[model samples]
Target chain A: MVIVSVAMLILFCMIYLIPGDPAAVALGPRATDAMREGLRIKMGLDKPVWVQFWNFFFAAWQGDLGRDVLSDRLVATVVMEQLPYTLALIFGGISWSVALGIPLGCWAAVERGTMADRIVGVLSVAVIAVPSFVVAIYALLIFAVALRWLPAIGAGEPGDIGDQLVHLILPSLAVGLGWVGYIARMVRASMLEVLESQHIRTARAFGLPERMITYRYALTIAILPTVTLLGVGIGQMLSSAVFAEIVFARPGVGKLVYDAILTRNYPLVTGAVLVTTILFVLLNLLADLIVGALDPRVRSRL
Target chain B: MTVLSIKDLNVTFSTEGGRLHALKDVSFDVPERRIVGVVGESGCGKSTLINAILGLLADNGRVDAGSITFEGEDLTRLGPARMQELRGQRISTVFQDPMGALNPVLSVGRQMRNIQYRSGRSRSEKDARSEAMLRQVRIPDAQAALARYPHEFSGGMRQRVAIAMALMMRPALLIADEPTTALDATLEVATIELLRELQQDIACSVLFISHHLGVIAELCDDVVVMYAGEVVERGTTRQVFHTPRHPYARRLLECDPARQSGRTRHLPTIPGEIPDLRQRPPGCVFATRCDQRVDACDKVPPDVAVETGHVARCVLAEAR
Candidate 1:
């Protein structure tokens, strides 16, 4: 909770400190100097920085993020309108990463020092080395330009479920690319360490079947650290969504925040940042709970 | 009748440096319903022997030569599935560190129930059996312990839980790998006593491995003294302790601090460190430290009969 407050405070200061005038942007170059001054006071931009922060702090608590300077709409409403699309894209990305990453990691650990292990090691490294945006561009070219299997740009129309899903495919793949390498590597390392633990040897000595030994015994312990990684992976997806949304022309918080900053939309920028930070915090808390549930030693500590 | 017999066993471990011969021409037997103790210092192949017999040798280890026969079947030739079936059913192990032996994540009852999967019993029946086994090992609130995780138990209590789990299936042979080494002195003695009483009640043979000579002398009917991957002496506990024939065995007995009388300036110690397995001596593995070494000690000493059912691998014993 403290983290969220601190993050918002930092973001608020950085956004205002930038060389941009919200009142000037709202009134445009044609407006007279007296008109700009009047608008600055009306929007509270003429207030002291501390007073402005205090007002934002109180208003945010009540979910009143003020109005966007350009659109003159409530910033919260603007963010809420685009929230579902960003969330859907992130959900699909996380699901894809876990579904592919876990089995590949298990297979690599089980076949350590074998050809399969080497292939997985090399491929994951290559994937991590290439940035997510590069993967996005390649995905756009191959799937959209050449094969024409899916839409190339923009979020689908409202209330059209099939079109929304079709538009989500390329962007989700781009966001998921970064997570696949990170999660797979973590799972493989964790599995190898767990496999060598003495309790695993004890389980083997007890004559449990190979399946039980690997999945039931080793996997349970191995998956704990990976759970934490997946939490961090969600935050990565959020940041990556900024670029992904821009490339695909999707209606999302990422695009809203980017355009808000470019046009000096202070309320919109702060609202978007606050929502993303809270989501990240919640995801991490869930990860900790899952970890505590999986491991008795940690659970007792908690 | 012998319940388990190992003949001419040889185990080697391949490592980054080279192959290390861990065991050489070792042979012993556990008579039906009898306890046999294997005594040695650290790195004397005690764990290697146990792992080889259990078919749990590490990835780099191999049973290069030998046959481990239990009851009537050869374990080395058995397939993995058959070996797994035999394991925990006919041959169970109680490891030294109880905290490491039991999975901390699993409840005590759940871990015990896993072993009963092949018994074809229902979950509640397995739970009842686990409680009964815990009670057999003298754990307090046996029923409540079933719901607790392994970490909640104290060290001695965990060892008892381990013992209960090992004996749950009524295995024919129990291999205890210094199961009491990690406990306090009082707990150590109590755990050992519990082990003996329970072993008798179950009527199963035991192969006890420990580096502590006192533990071997107290519990073993037959004792095998191992030095540098080789069995230097084998005889009944009484025969070996009273009249040790091998020079190393004689020195080992002298090194026991309990045997020293009051006001001794220094307790006895064998002169040198145990030779590394990578550089085993040309003949007698203990010859480098033996006080009675002769020129012929450079050659492999044959097993010479020192008494009925007693043997010592030494040139001096051969001369006698």
Candidate 2:
């Protein structure tokens, strides 16, 4: 809650500092001076910056993020409509990354210094080195343009779950591919460390099968850092999702903010950023809670 | 009858320098229901010997030659599956640091149940067995203790839990690798007593390894002294302690703080380090450090039998 309020304040300040009058942007170049002045007063832009901030902050605290200048609709309603798409994309990216990353990490660790391990090592580094936007562009060109197997643009028909999921495949892949590298490397390093621990040796000494020792005994502890990484990864994915959303032409909170920023839609941009920050903070809290549950030493302190 | 016999075990580790002969011609036995202690300094290959017997040597280390024969089977030749099957069922181990040996994320009951993975018993029955073993180790409120994690207990109690888990299956042989070295003086004695009591109750042969000569004298029936990967001396605890034949074994005993009669500013210590294993000396391993070294000591010393069962690798063993 504290983080959300602070984020709102900072967003408001930054948007205010940006050189462009929202009134002029809304009115266009042919408007007379009288008309621009009238529009500025109506949009609450005539007040001092501090008063403008107070008004915006108070209204936002009461669940009102002011009205969009061009559309004349509530910013909160606009954000609510677009949030679900962005959330789905972020979650899909995270889900697939975890699905692919963990097993690859465990396999590489189990086969520590072999050809398979070397291949995974090289591939993970390659993916991480290439930015997500570059991946998004290349993926768009290959899958959508050249291969026309999937849809090229839009988030599909609004109410059709199957079409939206199909459209989601490419964007989520672009957003999540790099994270797969991050997660796999993290899991591999921690797994190797845990494998060297005395408890693992003791487990082997007691005659547990190699499979049980690797997956059950070692992985349970090794996956802790990866869980924490997932929380932070979601925040990073949100920024990457903007590129994915724009490249794929999907209607999401990130694309909404991107369009609003171009049109000087301060209310919409501030509201969307504040909401995403809140969600990120909550997701990190969830990660910490999961770690506490998994490790008893952490649980006792909690 | 021998519960476990290691015959001419030769193990080496490949390093950037060269292949380190970690254990060379090392051999010993744990007779039925007897406690055999291997005493040596830090780099004397005690751990390498244990790893060899358990087939748990590091990736760089390999058994160059040897056979660890237990019962009617050779452990060196056993496949991973068979070796795993024999581990907790036929042979278990208690490690030096109890906290490091038990998983911190798991409960005592969960780990105890896991150790009995081969039992093919139901969860409730396994829980019952775990409680029984904890009770045998004299852990207070053994039932409640099972639900607790390893860090929840004090150091001594955790060691007790490790012992309980190790002995739950009534293994034919138990390897205790410096199990008491991590505890304080009082806790060390208590842990040793608990281990002794548990061994007698379970009627299992124990292969104990430690540098504490007094602990060996108090607990073991026989002792083997290792120097630079070789078994320098072997005899009954009485014969070896009362009449040490090998110069290294004799020097090791003299350095024991418990054996000193008067207060002195300087503690007795063997003057030289163990020989570098990367290039094994052609002569006796202890010759450079031996105070009574003669011209003949420059060659490989013969294994001289000073008595019926007592043996020492030294030129002067027969004379001494």
Q: Which candidate should be chosen as best, given DockQ against the real structure?
A: 2
Q: Estimate each model's TM-score.
A: 0.97, 0.97
Tell me the tens digit of each residue's lDDT in model 1 across B193-284.
99899889999999999878888888889999998888989989998999999998899898998888887988888889988787677899
Cα RMSD, each candidate: 1.7, 1.7
Q: Model 2 over residues A143-193: C-alpha lDDT tens digits?
A: 999999888778889899999999988899999999888888999999999
**Ten-residue region with minimum lDDT total, candidate 1 chain A:** A177-186
DockQ (CA atoms), all models: 0.75, 0.87
Instruction: Quote the positional error of residue B120 for candidate 2 in Å.
Output: 1.1
Error of 2 at A73 (Å): 1.7
Docking verdict class for candidate 2 = high
Query: Candidate 1, what DockQ?
Result: 0.75
